[model samples]
Target: MTETATAPAGGLPEAVFDPERLAAVAASGLLDTPAEGTFDDLAELALAITGAQKAFFTVADGRRSFWKAAIGLDAGAVRENDIRDSPCHILIGTGLPLIAEDAVNDPRIRDLAAVGALGIGAWAGYPVVSPEGHVLGGFCVVDQDARPFTPGQTRALQTLARSVSSEIALRQALRQARAAGDASAALARTLQDSLLPPRLAEAPGMDAAAAHLAADATGEAGSNVVGDFYDLFHTRGKNWAAVMGDVCGKGVDAAKVTALARYTVRAEAGQHTHPSVVLHRLHQALAAQRVSDRYLTAALASFRPAADGVGVVGRYASAGHPPALIRRADGSVEELDAPGTLLHPDLPPAQDALKDTTFRLFPGDALLLYTDGITEARDRERGPLFGDARLARTLAATRGWDAARTVDHLRRAVREHSGGHAVDDTALMLLRVAGGPA
Candidate 1:
């Protein structure tokens, strides 16, 4: 029989804890996990169906209710709420649907957080049951104003709660579905795309070109996202900065570090004249926040336009990252002599290794910043890498090309080198000074 109750008939469900119910909640594994679009979509659907301003898919862990999915909550809202403060405290153990026609006056829950801090005047919820008949969590609808749930509406919501339970099951299976490459790869790619900038911004007096592609193009494994990333931004003092970096590993772990490094560098961009200063800031930030051995190497360069406007001068720093190269108007290639200290909390003296190199870019000179993935791409899965010499030749041949053409040319060359499949994550950024001698 379907269980429905407006309020607890007994003292309360949590005066005592049930081990079996808590175990089912733990097995669901929905607490404190990464937010996924699948859950967001379901929450959205729930909001529309109930015509409620907010909907939350949550699991109660005895002391607090953890929201796995929520819509209409502020960005800074805490995801967990104290059980004593929430009306859902009693809902957790009962396994019965709750419909408070006037929650603000409902003696059973009027003193809860739903009515006070949250200002929620009315609410309805359905138990989320697994196939084994364990109530894993509950789906809830909330409103700031008074409202009531009809019998038909409550039944519809019950069905949706079951869907949410199934989604949790699907995601758990997907996590363990590493042997099935396609599903995990799709999820990884979704996360990777979210971390990457959709497109590079256009910097004045420069032509910018950028590209990113997955390493496992053949889909032989899940987690195809790679460690390479690039950025172009206008900094303070009428200058522009170009950044290229590679995290130490691949997939989700590397992507996490990539996101941290990119945002930290961008945060310090406008304040520094030399790239080394920014790298130092990121080094300290990561050192204080990190618990693992993860680190990334970065190449940072700041460009200030010359008064003549015919070219620009670049001040660069390298932290164990690949050295950037310049292709002059006459097609000669020179690698900038930037210091190559790797950023790590383990090395206290490496900051001095961060030397700044200054170079003049006369009109028609192109600067190329890239991650090692490009030069190290293998033609076959286990073949020789496409090393530095080949990259030099490719740059020399592209001297006759523009900024965009140079990037396109390199992409084609890499494709040829890797036989159209990348053996590692790859990224490239090309910046050409606006003019070349006619």
Candidate 2:
């Protein structure tokens, strides 16, 4: 006979203090750990997108809620608090998103001492769950002024919460790999895949395609774990954003920087339309991390379908990255030049160097964003480099192809040029206006 699952006598699941749930949290390795840029970036993004006065990424057990990252709260003074006092308790109780327009007046939590002690006017949050489906804590925000949050803001907060969940899972995997002698390479591959989106988001009136070729093109697992990434996603309304970046190194450290940069751009893209502004925000995040050896080159594009429905208007920005290539409908390829320095703490201020260059993609036109791998590939070891000239010519030759075909054709060309061997990770993203080839 099957037994029916029942809630605790107190009408809750006992999830907050459940031993299995607590074990999962412990495995995350986030409890009492120092703040990290990945978590800080998420919390900061939550504040920026929601206009919240305070935000926190927390891990909670029965006894207390530990702040992994916080913004606007004095870190030294507000490291943690009793679990009963945190607004996140509501999330743990219901296993659903919680929003209280006025925590001080809400009957459910008004009596809680934290309501008066912390002076929380409003609260909004989503659960941060483990890979095993246990809710460990939450990504939450507090407002000093009691104001209702719009649906868009709440959704944005949810997106950031999911990012928190992913980061926790990555850390757990890394720890497990370290403990298991022969699993390091497998962990590296898993972490590398997590850095990229599983698939590109579809856009109206446009075709988007992307490809990634690992340094080990022979399909040797764990042999290469580099930091080349590309992303395409909707911002708000009809606007969409795309970014391609090459972080400086390999393995876990490179993966950390890659994750930081990717999410930082996503967070900034929703609030800004100018590519330079978005990238500069990412630069600030990297600088805040204060890792001298970690830096990157990136290209960003913000665009929306033109009112005529036959083309797109967009702004492009570059940070120590190669110029993006645009292929006209007439099969002519030209470099869309927008230059800047590397994204590093030692680099000059982004506002002074990074600038947006506006351009339009007419019908049948295609734009390509890529890493240096394609241009740097050589015919053989210590042989002539493929360089920009050949890349431009190859792009020009693909006049009328759709985004997918163009990406495939280019990948083939690079492979042939390098004689079937890859020296570095390669990432290519192509955006084409919906019309057929030129």
Candidate 3:
């Protein structure tokens, strides 16, 4: 392979070869990832806008040219080649578009192999620049016929190139945002996992599954997920306890509150037999800690096995949290409406120290307990909340599914309604009797 003879047109300064442009191209993280339709689509539009036969969008890093998109050429056909042998070098070296009206006659790039070997008669291309004014490559259209490009056609090509530049710039911003978000999500996930039970202990009478959603999800990847936690632990005489809650705030403070609530529940549920007593104990613990400007909202359910029967009875209670929803085997849905006070002193005292709502879960029945973040999540920024009705409808549809499937279906529904990310922390706990009616 012979490198073609080349020279810097228009007395280009040596500063143009500073190598920073190559680093900028790499920093955008757009090279060699995948051929996105975004760039290809833009090239197609450029082809139509310029009335040319073919179009290409590329990224050049001073050393070589790599095609990001190609309309008529095979994929990876122009992946790498010397800068001088390629027409794109004209744009990179001159910092201006190369509008070769007639490549066979135009001295600018006539001797280049792009014209001599490929028979490309005309080229109307502009630079695809980065946000920092680095020339990445060319968004160009080519023709097999020798023809002159009108000034209007040339201007339109420049405008389309600007649009391509804007798109490339957007990708760079998204890459940076995801990087920062990933860092935050990693730490938050570690903290969140540490605060939660490693796994929900298998109960004697039911199948259990749980999923948590943090408000930190900004892109396809998530970050800085909020403080929502749950636990299913066996406690006291052939029974199990289910705990789900949200801390008053987010990050480390909210994580601390989550840990305090879970441990307090675990410590107290063993000594006690009633739901209200456990909640009352939790309220006392939070109050005594004096976690300034912080409190927790929670729900606890204790399941008691029926003597030689096909079902279990559950006693449920909550402190300033959303009521639980249950889907019966017969496809009936009901809410365990327990009015419990938020831990703050300004709210009504925990009535009867947070009353319990006892519900029966027979074979093929499911009990779902979740934090308000699920229902309170909005369709868009400041949009209406997903609300209780939607959740009930979602549960009604997942009547006979097992715990894992039920939680998955409900999570998908919430994500669809909230445009794929919760604005607050979301925690879902689904517990179902394992088999069909015994």
Candidate 4:
């Protein structure tokens, strides 16, 4: 199909040509880029489910629609064309999906020259948005015959579109963060915060809370950006996940691995019910790309509210990380005994060492996941490290406490133990089952 006029069409919104939105499109790095497997997979899935004749994952600049991935289109077909010639521009203008079940007679674009040239009987496009909420382009499907899409198909297409948005946003965020390496503590804090969940996902029948105490809590200049990250999120169905990890080094290198570990676990946790499998998948991802020589230790748990409503039941795995702790409602603490090797691409045999065990959190009981920073804190005189024994004793003293209070209590204890000078960053997540005894 030949290119069309560059001006906005009659029904298209003028915002499609906004300068900032166009800038976001440029920053997306999707325009004119080589095809990517992720985008290709999205296009393939879109076509598979919709039974569409063709699919396109595209990015649009002011004048041209650049195809990032296309399926069912011949190699000689135009890969880039005037933005006005494609319905994706309508999605950009409206910031919404453009679905034309009968594109040949669809008033919005039937008059366009390319519609007849491409023989589009039906068309559906979902906006691929930027992190800042700008419409960068779209994931669209085209059919040779007019077809009505079911609600289920529409929802699936929307989900796939969101995955595309997430992939782009993550790449953009990490690029910006790595580019800011060793720049400023304020920037370091911002970059570190980006690696963590903005807030913990609400857990059914449980109280969830988390905190990160930076090694440089004093707000001093030139503090190393250590890799201590934690996340609490809901996986598929009734399943929920909690993870805590510490990368081997500091600064942008650590941040890169931290981002990778967090994203990989998130992408895999929904597919697997076992933490060990999720963690092993993470290992494979890390091994596939040696971003750095740095290795990391992680604790991952997948749990769900019990059918009896008495507590939570799930399995947790440890990879050369400290054990997770359970503080019973009666004020006694029990240590978990799952240990495995640290995560490094080169440590294939260590995968066998990874172990996961079933556990339950009864009402009034709390589950604690933490990095070693808390246990390794020393006093101002650099005396004995705070150690696991003290942590257990302290946790046992916080009986009947909610997750929030438990986490706060531990943070204060660590701060005082270290005389307000932590040698490393500390991260903690606690989930307390409801209806605990007073």
Candidate 5:
């Protein structure tokens, strides 16, 4: 077959390759593929347009030369050659395709006996470059008889090469995205596990339990672990203190804040006798950081044993979180009205206040402290929130059970109400007042 140079009317600069572009192309993992229809079509089109006997696509990955697709060449003919001896390798380094009308007269290939032995006298090549300017490979046509390429044919090959480059870029981007997603998921799992205590601390005169559920559909696993956290600890005076709170956002930053808030409450509660005073201390500690935009909504409560006639007393304070639900032994549920403002000092005055409230815990009574994630959980069918009223009703229904049983029922109810899909992180602390202090 005759090899002819078909160039568009005007002479155009040849395609150039660069080291940065080569690196990007090398990363795509597209080289050395078995013939696919897409590449095969391009090869066949190249031969038809250039009127050459053979056409091929070659990718060079530093150490190896890979022929992705080829026409009119034996399958076994596709093999890696020494880069030092390959004239095409030199042309690639120059960032331009080599157009040789006669290999015997071309200085770059004249001394290369392989071209003469293969009966290849004419050659034309176009560099395949990625959008970011990486040279992935080259598309070329060859013939036994020498001829010149027309301008139109050269342009057609260049267009086809660009299409190949785009595919390479798309594949590379997808790989990067998947890798990022995997890393994020691993990080989320680690953060969630680290923030939660390995086991809940048992307290006398109270059956204490905590539950935290993270939304499954939010950002990448490690990208955003909702920052809701809860903890139960004993004070130096033997009273039991519990705190539940949610940081303002999800992800790593929020997790950091959640951890800080949790420890701040525990430390302050141990030093103070009243829950309100403990909460105030936590606010001040957080305020000192000057992170006014990053706030936490929390409930801090202390359970103290009562004297002769009086039952146990639960003193609690709220900072922008949902009010605590108290289930009395009489099968009634009361929403304790606490006074508090959101934790951020810079928030408007209307939102910066804190509320402190008290509740008398009779024998077998239970108290539930939770973040807004529970009440705001959406119902699957109606798209409305599960809401505080439903939470109250649920607690009332489960009031007959002990602390552990009540928490179990409440968790199930919340999950069901949200269609088994938690859209935010939910943290709950349940404290049951036993018949007498243990």
Candidate 6:
């Protein structure tokens, strides 16, 4: 339940509670449990310190009052009150301790037969609160005669109540952390489904397929979604464009930037003919956003259908990203060297030194582009990473397969190498030039 505190009267310190903290407190699985030895010890100590006939830990969960632990009282009998309607409700509502000298004479307690039945004429109670400032319950003491508690006794009980509050607060914090983790997982799943295309666009005289798999772990919820994206589209002139890249960082921020990069590449490819020029325009557009400490690593390739053979020409740029893999039809795999500095780096000269590389795709040749997540995945024992050499060997083994099958095999190999532990988000795109006599 949400609660707001009013300023204390007569210059006394005010008691405050936070609504969110209370929600978290309610989420803890500790409420309404049978009395245990640890709590009984606490109540016993409280009664001894306050010199009261009985002391108890009472929790009110909207419906009934439950005694989680009690001393000098029957555990079963303490469950008889509708605490929401009790005279003591005012004390809890105000988040202040209440002390009554004579319940028989005090109009507020006179009608409370439960207290008279127990032969109690005096009482004192302090509210227990979670760290986020939600009221969880109360710690209370009672006597059979009309008597005022000493200042020292009241202070001691207040201190003990604070201890109970701290316990509640700890439980609340754990619950909130778990909830946030669950929410982040759900968000990552949604982002992956919405951002990545289901299938690649078909190209004439060439075969292409792409697959993207985000790491199952590493975010606010233990799964980071990296800014990696890929796209395939056909231009007005019937030329096919395929692009793949990775953006810096991970999580929601990186995911947003990844989406922007994907669209930027597609839009520019539609407007520009040259793959190098399209990447240049994309860099300018992304740089214009003024994103702090952000940049993209990209590769753009165009394919045109030929009467005798398919022609594939591509230009790739790296902004602090790993190189791509090229697999020949003859079972040879090599890494393409595309050297460029990260965008928005601390040093302007390093950014200016960035350059692109152009390559021609021979018949039966394939190009593979991916995010660092695939290369940086750790082994089963969390030891060395699955480096580029392993990836090259895997690609070489699958060189004779179709583009779709090649991508599938590579994905399986990466998963196996990492022992199913994908610590970073990964994206992979494959383009194959069909074989025929020129």
Report the alpha-carbon TM-score of model 3 versus the true structure: 0.55
How do the predictions measure up, each by TM-score? 0.58, 0.69, 0.55, 0.67, 0.54, 0.53
Candidate 1's residue-wise lDDT over 411-435, tens digit each?
Answer: 8888887888776777888888777
| Stretches of model 5 off by over 4 angstroms after superposition | 1-182, 218-223, 290-292, 345-352, 380-382, 436-438
Candidate 2: regions farther than 4 A off? 1-119, 124-138, 141-166, 172-186, 217-224
Top candidate by lDDT? 4
Residues 1-438 of candidate 4 have per-residue lDDT tens digits of: 111123235755676788989998989877777778888988999889999988888898888889998888887777876777877788787665677888888887787666887789988877787655578888888899999987667656765676677677657766776677635554556667767776787888889899998876444423555588888877667899999999987766776677767766764686678898888877876775566778999999999978887798989999989999999999999987587889987877555787789999898999999999999988758898989999999999999988898899999999988888776888999989898798
Q: Give the per-residue lDDT of model 6 (tens digit) for 206-249.
A: 78888877676644424566467787777545677777777766
Indicate whether candidate 1 or candidate 2 has the larger lDDT.
2
Report residue 130 deviation for candidate 2 (angstroms): 10
Candidate 4: clashing pairs of residues? 364-436
Model 2 earns a TM-score of 0.69
Model 5 lDDT per residue over 222-261, tens place: 2445477787877655577888887776555565565556
Ranking by TM-score: 2, 4, 1, 3, 5, 6
Which consecutive 10 residues in model 5 have the weakest lDDT in total?
A: 4-13
User: In candidate 5, residue 133 scores what lDDT?
Assistant: 42
In model 3, residue pairs whose N, Cα or C atoms come closer than 3 Å (at least 3 residues apart or on different chains), thus clashing, are: none
Cand. 6 Cα-lDDT = 0.65
Those runs of model 4 whose alpha carbons end farther than 4 Å from true positions after fitting are: 1-184, 217-223
Please state the error at residue 24 of candidate 1 in Å. 36
All-Cα superposition RMSD per candidate: 17.0, 9.5, 24.7, 9.2, 24.9, 22.1
Q: What lDDT would candidate 1 get against the real structure? A: 0.72
**On residues 140-159, what C-alpha lDDT tens digit does candidate 3 reach at each position?**
88898888777666656655
Model 3 residue 73 CA deviation in Å: 82
- Candidate closer to the true structure by TM-score (higher is better), 2 or 6: 2
lDDT of each: 0.72, 0.79, 0.72, 0.80, 0.67, 0.65
